[model samples]
Target: MSCTSSSMDIVPDDTFNDFAPLSKRRRVSDCSRSCEDSSCAPLKKFWFPDGDIVLEIQTRLLKVHRRRLQCSVIFSDMLHIPQPFETDQIDGCPSVALVGDALADWEVALAWIYHHDEFLNQVVTFDILSGALRISTKYEIPGLRRWAIEELSSRWPVDVVSMRLNALPHAAEAITLAQECNVPEILPAAFYALSVQKFHASADGGRSHLVLSPNDLRRLIAGREALQDALLRIAVDPLTEPGCANNAACAHCAPRRAEYWRARLAPDPKSPWSTWLVRELDWMLRDDAFAGTLCPACFHGHMSTIKWRLGRLRGAMPGFFLL
Candidate 1:
């Protein structure tokens, strides 16, 4: 039941249908069935006698008011349909079976719907946000879906600069979620975050949870190589440092600056070049001592060149991933 990507496997493509009809609904699997009588218990927190409709999930039922769900086009249409004679009833309320959904997803979605004010004010977890996103997309709830996407965007931004600033946890899971759901925009950022992480083989020789799908692995490798190439090109490019007004001092400092860059920017076995560009740039810019040996003109020029080239690379990251 852990929602973190590190503990989960890649979700299959056909795991959930976006708008499956109720007529084609499949019965809950026998393993998930609570008892021999095929009866389901009400979920403790969501059950309410005063609620108008009862929703039957795999092993539990949830009673919620019609008004709360009517905002969703799919839910509204489903609710208006006349119930058949065989339709189950819970405490005189018509019960509808929800197909192709996980109970956890519904729990998160329903909690948000019923207590949105409180939920919005509270610190949201990835589990709650991802669950809400999945359920809202299934039910065609635009408002909740938008809210979930916007919340996720803050952590995994579309642009490279913001994405570098906001590091996301469980990036592999986020990538899977993007592929499974319709959130393609966050894929580039998620993939970039995953690329720099070092995943080791499991002790038992089993597949690691951090392992990505074959296609994703290919894309990650290609994109990471592309980024590394871009960084290397920028690092080795000739510096256009026109001698400052004090030409002698500036000329003397130039060779030292080149040597410093060669030593500091050289590729390290432990650290990836793709991730080092920003970190090194920040280090040099933050502390004047790092760039103190160079003349002001040379220092500013080198920094500007690094920024410009990296910015261009960042812009092309999505294309590098074949996205």
Candidate 2:
């Protein structure tokens, strides 16, 4: 009966459907939104709520006696790269910046830093050259680099590509700084291929072929691996989510979704999700932090893949795995 989860609460699978029931009339998921902003408010009903939904079906409402809806339901049918789900804490974009003082030798340090952050596709800034040099790659420097990496990755993901393309005389320390502040995007084969062609132009005869060949991109995707803790699942978009209509990368959403139900249904008598969910709602309503909004079926169909992949590796892996 011990409590689990950040907040000890409990709920059952049988009751999960009660909170967000799909209306028989609409037959689609209700699009309810919530955020951290105090002034911002979630819609009382979903975009296509069965009854009195503000925005439904994009159909025209009564022009003469219209309810005079305050806001329009903007359907974001973005292409190429759209934003991620609102629940996630971080965006998948990489943040890179140049960092170096007016008087500092940043050759070796900068290159190594660049390579490290570049390889991880994380944030990097050269302005903190002194701080970067302080990070000992050889010796174990407890707080300097290790903690920063954890903190930033937990909050935001930065793009190292932004740094490589933007800065000159690569500064490793600066890149590490940005990486320390944010994680980076794990580009997929299709996206990388497109990006290479977009930026690195092709040349004929005396021209330079800057684009990455198909084989190079293949090797890149093949070599990619999951996070050490199974905490992060870096999947190439469209590969797993072929029919997905939205655009954006959400690394945390997948791996975390993979385990949410299991975590709640592990048969702990105390019941982590149900108990805390109600309690949190009660507390948040009083504190005015949040309301009925909960994560939709994002976890659906995701847990199986996470478990299956973990099972394959766990049988031969070490004990330190977070699984």
* Best candidate, lDDT: 1
* Lowest summed lDDT window (length 10), candidate 2: 70-79
TM-score of each: 0.76, 0.19
Q: Show where candidate 1 strays beyond 4 Å.
A: 1-18, 21-38, 83-86, 164-166, 201-211, 234-251, 259-274, 279-293
Give the clashing pairs for model 1: none
Pick the TM-score winner: 1
lDDT of 1 by residue, 192-300 (tens): 7766554442221122245567788788878778777765664674344233222232576667766666666666656422245545554555556756656677677
Number of clashes recorded per candidate: 0, 30
Q: Residue 26 of model 1: what lDDT?
A: 36
Per-residue lDDT for 123-209 in model 2, tens only?
544333334334322112233345344433332223222222222122222233343433232122112112222112221101212
Cα displacement (angstroms), candidate 2, residue 313, comes to: 20
